[model samples]
Target chain A: MQFPSLEYLIFFPLAVAAWYAAAPRLRWAVLIGAGAAFLALASPTHFAFAFVLSLVNYFAGLALERWAETRKALWVLLATLAFDVGVLGLFKYGNAVLAGFAQLEALFGVAAPPRVLSLVLPLGISYYSFQLIGYLLEVYWGRQPAARHLGHFAATILFFPKLVAGPIERPHHFLAQLAAPKPFDPADVTAGLKLLGWGLFKKCVIADRIAFVIGPIFGHPRDFSGLPLAAAIALYTVQVYCDFSGYTDVALGSARVLGLELAPNFNHPFSARSVTDFWRRWHISLSSWTNDYIYRPLSMVISFHTSWRRVGTVFSILVTFGVLGLWHGATWNFVLFGLLHGAAVSVEALTSRARTRLLGRLPARVADRLNNVVTVVFYSLSCVLFRANSISDALYILGHAFVGIGHAAPIGAKRMFGRQYHILLLGLVFGALVLGRWWTRRRPVAARPTWQRWPVYYAVIAAIVILGLFQVNQFVYVQF
Target chain B: MTPEAILLEVNKVFAEVFGNPSITVGPTTTAKDVPEWDSLNHTALIAAVEKHFQIKFSLREVMRFQNVGDMCALVRAKTGG
Candidate 1:
């Protein structure tokens, strides 16, 4: 069920209540059972796929650990990864492949592509699959042990809150939490509930509200000039962050309420001062996974083939980002998005020292501010590729974003805001998010009294109640 | 190479790459303690260490090192000093 759905609203509280009512030893059983029921509700047919995927990874990890010889472990690990990738390909990309074949047939005036059994994507396939792969690889490399308990491993993959979307917990961090007994910590629960409310505010009040404008602009990019399109792009940047980060907060909060500590996913990514820093803050789990598995290994190969001081760095960046892009989806747009980021980062890597040298004469704060501006602009431009539906659309937006600068469009402020001042609302919400994060980061918390804290808490609660009463929206990252 | 001499050269490389004047690193020091010691910097640091020590780190070793001490001990083990 969607996070905003009445079904989820009812189900979440009921699940939490039932979970705590059960003995500590049986809490996991309650969660798994409820999570299974929820999965069945979402897509009963695909629930089996998740089960099988988890089983495969669990055994694969065991095999990797048990094998005495490194070569045997390596073989088992590769075989397991292949199987997981095969399952993902079949369910996720099967339709696209069939459609491509059909298009080819029509172009040739030949027979049409056969109608294959279309399978619905199981919830959390992309996330769990990646986690499974990382788990097996880690075990094979002796980074972590194989999880002995099948039930615990199953819960790791199927936990309801993050089952649909995730912060993508590593086996080491997540499994350890799973082994601990559930404690009824009122403070943790309170913090978790507050985090959940804040997440909902981001999704419903900020992201969904912004989507009203962003959706229209993307739909008809040709009609909108530089100003509207740029506005849409800016709004989209916020929308995506809120939607994804909002989902993570809820996921983490839910897990927190259950006495499980999930990792924080987003860290005010927009405030990142470089593409590399952006990756570090945004979708941290995925980025770290890519770094450990893809970039490091690939870099080693590149370094071996050529001297470390020479060709390896550029090659590694391009290849790493290319793989990263492909991982997001099969679309050409994602590929270009990855390449643009890769190129930007490679350029950043190459010139950082020289740039630092040139800027070294400036005051430290001044240099930092200048660096921040340059990085944000660069990162935003790259995001044009990410937000656009197609490569052509991306090119069009970039072309206009650059060329449409001199001439302002004739669109009214009211219309631009959408009906009910959504643009203004989106701006205010986004401004509040950035400003609050900045304020929190800048201010010393110990200096603030409880009197200062209570007002902020009340204001946040009021905002959530206000937003929830009016509307709710699905998080963006659930699709991935 | 003597372990002490190898360490001195490696220390020099670390100081240069990290741009720290008085790093005073011990074997126990780690990336977590160093501001500039992120993934990209880690890779550069490894390369610099390799050049200075004349020893190559396997992928497993590179990935597994927990601290500067681990790296130093590993390097020493490989070099048989």
Candidate 2:
């Protein structure tokens, strides 16, 4: 169930009650059980598959750690990845492959048949699969110890709040909390609730509201033109950020309520001055994951080979982002989304060096401002690929949005504002996001007192009640 | 190279890239210990290490590193000190 759902709204409190009531030793089991049952609401059959997969990874990690020989551990690690990928491939990408084959057969004028299976995706498979893989790799390499208790290990993989969609908790970061007994902290509970409320405001109010304008245009991009398309793309930027970050807030907050702190998934992404900055801010968990697992590894290949270092960096960026894009879904649009970002990041890296030199030659502030503007525009353009349903549709939106800028049709000022109140609110949200980020940076979340935090909580709730759309669409990232 | 010597160079790189001349190098020191050791800066650190020691690190070696001590050990292994 989506974290913002009314059912989850009620479910969390009751679970919290039972959670704190249980003995410290049994608390992990209670949380895991509640989480597994919660997951069953999406698809009961898939839940079993999830359980089995969790067990496989859990045991594999332990075995990898126990094996004294490096070569033997490497074998176990490779086998585990292959098995996990095989299962993920069958469930997630199997349909796209089948469809691709059918079209190929049609091109050749032959009967191309489709394979049918229930093939329902379990909630958070993409997230948990990645988390599990990270755990295994860490253990195999001796970065983290394998949990002796199977239950604790399972709980780590299936922690309810962040299970389906996640901030992608790491083994070292999260497992220790599960093993230790946590004292009840009223402050943590209050803080977690405030975080939850802020998340709801983001999802229900800002994101959902923006989606109102964005959904229509994206649903049928052809019908709209000029200002509406541009407005829609801009709105989508808010919609996606609020939607995903909103979920992250609730996830992190709920886990906090349980006295388990998850990593922050987003910083102020919209305020980013460059595509590189954007990656730093956006989906921080995933971005950092790719950095560590994919990008760093690839960079090493180049670093070790002096001759291939430059080529390695380029190849790694392309392959890392390509995998990252495809990880979102098995679509050509997603591929382009990955490539576009990759290209932008490469450009940003190259320009940053040039920019440093240019700064010495020109007005630093002006160059910085110009760089920021160019970065925002590049980011918004790349997002067209991220938001569109197909490659052609993305091209259409990009082409028309930029085509004859300020010349095509004068967007009716009144009508535009009337239709997209959130568009106007975008300025406010962006403004608040900037201020809030600055404030948070100045004072860390841990330093804030209970009373000082209440205003932020109340404001978020007020935003939800007054502005939230309340029409739940599947979170964009949930499909992955 | 002794562990101390390797650590001195590691600390020098950390100090230069992160601009925290006071940052101490220890076996347990991690990114959390120094706020500026972020992903982007992480790349800078590895790049700096390669340039400093003239030793290449495989991706596996770089990713598997946990702390300053581990990184020093990896550099030593590669340089055959």
Clashes within 3 Å, all models in order: 1, 1
- Candidate with top DockQ is 1
Runs of candidate 1 exceeding 4 Å displacement: A97-117, A402-420, A427-462, A468-473, B1-9, B16-21, B51-54
TM-score list, all predictions: 0.89, 0.86
Each candidate: what lDDT? 0.76, 0.78
Q: Clashes in model 2: which pairs?
A: A204-A468
Regions more than 4 Å wrong, model 2? A107-109, A302-306, A362-364, A404-459, B7-60, B76-81
Q: Local error of candidate 2 at A317, Å? A: 1.0
Candidate 1 residue A272 Cα shift, in angstroms, is 1.8
The CA lDDT at A87 in model 2 is 84
Across A1-480, the per-residue lDDT of candidate 1 in tens digits comes to: 877677888998899898889887666677778778788997786578888888988888888888834788878877888999888888777877777888888889988547775577778888888888888877776767899988788878888888877777786677777788668888778778868877777777777877766675776576666676776777677778778888788788877777778877888776777788788888898888888888877777666556764367777778888877876776777788888888878887888779779899999888877877887777667777777888788888878865645333444333444345665665676678778778789674335688977777777767766754233345667766
TM-score of chain B of 2: 0.93
Q: Assess the local accuracy of residue A309 in candidate 2 as a C-alpha lDDT between 0 and 100.
A: 48
TM-score of 1: 0.89
- Shift of residue A435 alpha carbon in model 1, Å: 8.5
